[model samples]
Target: MFKIVKKWREQGTIERARGTGLENKKTTNNEDATLIQHLRAHPFTTATAAAQITNFPASRRTAQRRIRQISDFRCRVAAIKPFLTQQNKENRMGYAMQYLIFDQNFWENVIFTDEKVFQSSRNGKIRDFVLDSMKHILNKTIAVVDFPLMCGPGLVVGVPDCVGELMVD
Candidate 1:
């Protein structure tokens, strides 16, 4: 209370003074439009790469800040997908076309199997900036493990403390 009173007495108002810094030149409307276009064209590019590709005059950190200003944009872990060659793509398209005429009852009896290979490494995941509308395009998979049957006093049928064992099992 005393500090507030003293400050009020010293200054006429409690308003903050203007900052003594130059206005940001990198985040202008024209530069923002260019950055947005570059991101849309290459969503997986890093901030530094985007800045370098666009020939941005600002630092990489500034480029990152500008990216954050855009709405519905978020940095997320990249989905790992198998590399599909041209022949693989054509085969997948042909398979899809063959199944296009299947009715709901024909698809209802379909059984899909999920198989994932676990890797022991520290640098397996990759990060990327993505638009909100593009999230559904990414593939997401989770592995669920059920513990071996236990009939003892305490039957713990869940994941164990060891991550490596959980993945291996």
Candidate 2:
């Protein structure tokens, strides 16, 4: 408070000087446009490669910063997904259509079950052990327990049993 008052009394204004830093010249409007064009043509190109083609050559770091300034684009790994063929799509559509015609009673006779397995390091008497030890054998186990069946209103009998399991390492 005292410092602020003192500054106001002497300068009559409370404003701090902006920090000093070298101005960016390598990424002018023209150079930035060219860099963007290069990136669009070859998205996987490295920053150093893109910088080399600009009118005013810049470092990889400078090229990256300029690209960030232009847009919110960022490099990332592509997500993996299963590829579905035309036959797969047609089969899925047919299955869905068959279910759509079924009434509430038909759905009540469907019991869906799923199981998941997990593996982790085990602890020993002396100290906790890691899986790196060759003697250790990771137990891959699955447990199945009865679960309450809840399907709409009244209790339905004779539901067909279906089981599915997913294992990950």
Best by lDDT: 1
TM-score of each: 0.44, 0.35
Expressed as tens digits, the lDDT of each residue in 60-110 for candidate 2 is 787778777774445433233356577865665565455557788876765
Steric overlap count per candidate: 0, 0
- Lowest lDDT block of 10, candidate 1: 146-155
Residues 4-55 of candidate 1: C-alpha lDDT, one tens digit per residue: 6777899966655566345446456777678778766555556677788778
Model 1 has an lDDT value of 0.57
**Model 2's lDDT to the true fold?**
0.49
Residue 118, model 2, lDDT:
26
Q: Superposing every Cα of model 1 onto the true structure, what RMSD results?
A: 15.7
